[model samples]
Target: MNSLIYRALVELIQGLAVLMVIAYVMTRIPSFGDLLNRRLSLTHRVILGLVFGLMSIFGTLSSVDIFGGLANFRDLGPAIAGLLAGPVAGGMAGLIGGAHRYSLGGLTAEPCSVATFLAGLIGGFFYLCKKGRPIRIREVTAVMAGITLLHVLVITPLMLGLSNEIRQILKAVLLPMLLVNCAGVALFFFILQNLHRERLNEAEKHRIDSELRIAREIQMGMLPAPSRTGDPRYAVHAVLKPAKEVGGDLYHFFVRDENRICLAVGDVAGKGISASLHMAITQKLLKALAQSGEEPAGLLERLNRELCDGNETMTFVTLLVAFIDLRSGEAVLGNGGHNPPYWIRRGDVSRLVLEPGLALGIREQAVYTNQRLCLKPGDTLFLYTDGVTEAMNAHKELFGDDRLKTALLRVREKDPEAICRGIMEDLAHFVGQSEPSDDITMLVLRLESKEDAAAGAADGC
Candidate 1:
């Protein structure tokens, strides 16, 4: 009897180890995990039910048989199926395992098969009662204990073999089977719950990634492509490198007419999705107002009024709008709580000085002034967001105005695109491997010679 008890316990342990491996492997397979999580069709449920039913048969075959194959922990797989996958799955597994047990044809065969069916019924009952809620370990232990007692009561009275051998086997294996099955159920359910959680988390991540990708595409589409602005006198290029999937920085240029070109760059107070949305709204407003040929200061004033109308978010944008005359090279630059642009000419660099007001969406009825500057042939007007000057290195050092001025002087590009690319390269080298903390946006516009402008105008005609 002692050896029987020891061997039963050892068999139970080995069976549980195999069950753990099976559970782990199933979790790794996407189809199995999806089916268990109820994400698949009824066909998948039926397939899994059949599979787990076979697993119960396998558990029994692998266990130690004693007293003419009277008792074992064969019902573990069926119980788990019913509890985790609900009633239909449980019933299928129980029927399959029970059929196999009857085919073995022992004294305890009928009783064992009956016990398997009862195990499935009980598990399914509990699962139905607690729909959509995680089952606790204590609840599983209680169910297993009840199933074990029911098996003992039914089988002990009905055993057809010599009474003494039946009693000895029952005494040896009953307690061990109960202990093993209860522990196995708890471990198996816990793993199932964890796998469900992991699936949910992965699904959520995929959803967020898809949304960001779409948002990036939309944001890129909103800005005008710098390569072709439909003007020949002004060679213009712009770049916006957002630190995140979307950002608040914006730049736009449009030739309002034959003699006037409108240029604007703005930065919202924040970053990421919210900022990107605000920037889009600002761009639409600017484009709408630019069509009326509003001067730089008037345009800023009208934009501020529109933004502050229902500004519950309290977000603001610092903007710079400039109008350049294609024939005479006259620029009217307006500053609205934004960084002043740099004036580049004859190998010299200086910041454009302008009277400023609060950023848009802050104060209603805010007024602005336009500062005039005359651009000569070969003169370049460079505009940027704060992200350029405030870029930080690993040591917490900022790439300030001085470094930017030096970069501008060193760039050899006569075209706006090459110059913008050169400055971006310089900024990346300065930051090294440190991630940018903000969106970096830059726009360059170089005025061409009057003679060249005339010749280009003739070509367009």
Candidate 2:
């Protein structure tokens, strides 16, 4: 009995050493450190602790040859613990369990104790390394082979040399232990792979959500408010609807002085976050150059140069800038690969087409020229992004330019705000039952004579 007690105490010490080694290796792995930093909830940590504690107790029993030496399967529990709490916890459990088992039996020999400790240490190491990650099939096979080799070479000989009874017991238990360990490893890997995939999907969703919020704010800021007054001669009304969280459309109006109103509309090439960011930059630069009293053509030329200077990405913007002289009722329009504006008078419509130039950001030396239009009393001007004309219906039919022109002619006599709303409604009707595929923006301006304004105010109230 005394001899048995001595052997058991020695085995327990060996088990402890095994646990320490496993813990050390687990802590050294980068992924294990990352898991710890994620700060798993207290409940999860407590649950993992309980699991490891139980596995350690089982490991001790296995070492003592209690319950017919099948206690070696206790390693499976620690392997599971390592997979959940990471290698450190798993390894510590294995060591403590192995040490307890050794202490409870008289198997204190160097070979037996060392072999048991190594088994626990190796099992814990693999468990921690595979925590919250998928295990490759090849890696699983390799780990199984390595464990088998360790048992056959070190464990078999040690038990056989110790005594005939010990040899027979170990021989009977070894195959079963190997099968259990292999299954545990396989199960841990399966769980880890699923968890890793879920984590990646969640991370991607969070990133997209964050980007959408920023893009929405930038898009809203780029638009001109309904109450903004650029010049009293013209009442401007603009609205934008993005098909996605953010889009490439942009519009801005600034009163350079009492006499001059600077207005611009632009569409960046593409959609979503990248396009939205480019649109914001383009809007800011256009506003700055317009405020400096630069001619419409000169502003485009400057913008092209600024955009092309150091930009590595092949992004371009179609832009139209106009300077309206309220006193003379004349407007100077400039184009940089943009759609022409529509001029509406008494239900008759004409497009103000300018000489098209390269889109902004393509080349620094690209030039833009201006076209002049004289605004007639009660005449309206319409500017829009391509989304309006290119919208597709449920039947896959495009709401073409002809349809847009007809809609504008029908609503020419309406108020600026009403005209914009009318056009949007018409487009929606045309594209029945189909979701918008791009950013839609419309800006309508009607030049009212000072005499009509005074008469209109007097007629009202």
Candidate 3:
């Protein structure tokens, strides 16, 4: 009886080994290749089935001593097959292997084979469920407990009814096998958890990048292009350099009529899509008011009222709007919580000092003040957003208002295009290979009187 049981156990183990090999081969097939593709859904199912099949074979073969008269059924391959195959596969392997053993050899000594097969099946299930995720300490403990109970209730009782020597040998071998499978399962679980986390992080980064691209497109569309102008004496040049895909800075120049030029620059309160949307709305409102023959201060006041009427978020904007009369060379300027602009006359730079009022979108009844400046021949006005002064260097020092004023003095004689380019170049160099911290905007208006230039420098003296 002992020889037959041992032979049967060995045959069962061989059958399980064949099934493990079959699973590995099937995984290589394209249709089933995905199962072997690491942490995939089908991979988990295949691994589980392989483990159960191995366990069943191991238990069955051990019951019928098929090999040459040997009574020892000690083999690591079958248990290892279970460990690698995961829970479902391991359980099925165990069941099939156990049944084969019982059929080959009569139920002699004890029916411990049934219990051993069930333990293998349960272990396989636990491993399958936790294939791609982390395994907690509790999970390890639970698996160990289940394996121990199955062995004690089924295998131990049957072995106890057999000879003392047989029982003692089986006890020594089974304990070591259980320990090996438990350790393997715990290690694999930890590895799977880390992989899952890495995949999630990569996905999140891609989503953020996609959103930024969309925001950049909308922001660009809100600004006026160089080709939009129709006047000859009044030339306008503006540029926007965003530190990110979308930024808070904005500038627009439009000819409201043949004799009047309406221009405005603003900086929104935040960055990205939200700021860009606010900039679009502000530009539209200002253009509408200017086209209706409203004065600079009146336009700003109306814009503030519209912005603050029901807005509870308190998101505000710093703005500067100037209406230039081409025939008279006079400009009416409105200030709304923004930096003072520079007026350049014959290569000399001076600040246009005016009392700045509250920012737009803050108080519903806010008032704005206007200042007037007459543009003589060869005179220019430069308007900008705060991005110019807020640029940061490698040492984290801000290129503040003082530096900006100095840059303007250095480039006052250049044409409007050159002036805009020179200021941007100086800012980039000052930053010294550091990333820009905000959006940079610059608008330069050079008003040249047609009569003065045609009279061979009328004011040359």
* Candidate achieving the largest lDDT: 1
Tell me the number of clashing residue pairs for each predicted model: 0, 15, 41
Candidate order by lDDT, decreasing, is 1, 2, 3
Of the candidates shown, which would achieve the greatest TM-score relative to the real structure? 1
Point out the higher-scoring one by lDDT: 1 or 3. Answer: 1
TM-scores of the candidates in the order shown? 0.77, 0.66, 0.68
Residue 163, model 1: lDDT of 76
RMSD of 1: 5.4
Model 3 lDDT per residue over 1-461, tens place:
45544444445455444544554454446554334335535557555555445544543344323222112221222233344456455555555555555555543323544654665556556666766554574576456545644554446556555465555444444433344334433433343344346556767878888888877876687778843445557567888988788887878788888667887889989877778777778878878877777888999999999888777878899999998877667789998898778898876788889889889999888899888877766788899988898999999999988888789899887778888989988898999999888888899998765674324233322
Off by over 4 Å in 2: 1-78, 86-184, 230-232, 292-294, 429-435, 452-461
Query: Against the unseen true structure, what C-alpha lDDT does each candidate score?
Result: 0.83, 0.70, 0.66
Error of 1 at 242 (Å): 2.6
The positional error of residue 193 in candidate 1, measured at the CA in angstroms, is 3.5
Off by over 4 Å in 1: 1-22, 35-73, 83-145, 157-183, 393-397, 431-434, 452-461
Model 1, global lDDT: 0.83
The runs of at least 3 residues in candidate 3 whose Cα sits more than 4 Å from the true structure, single-residue gaps closed, are 1-145, 148-191, 226-230, 452-461
User: How displaced is residue 124 in candidate 2, in Å?
Assistant: 5.5
Candidate 2 structure quality by residue, lDDT tens digits, 164-188: 6655555555554565456545655
- For candidate 1, the clash count comes to 0
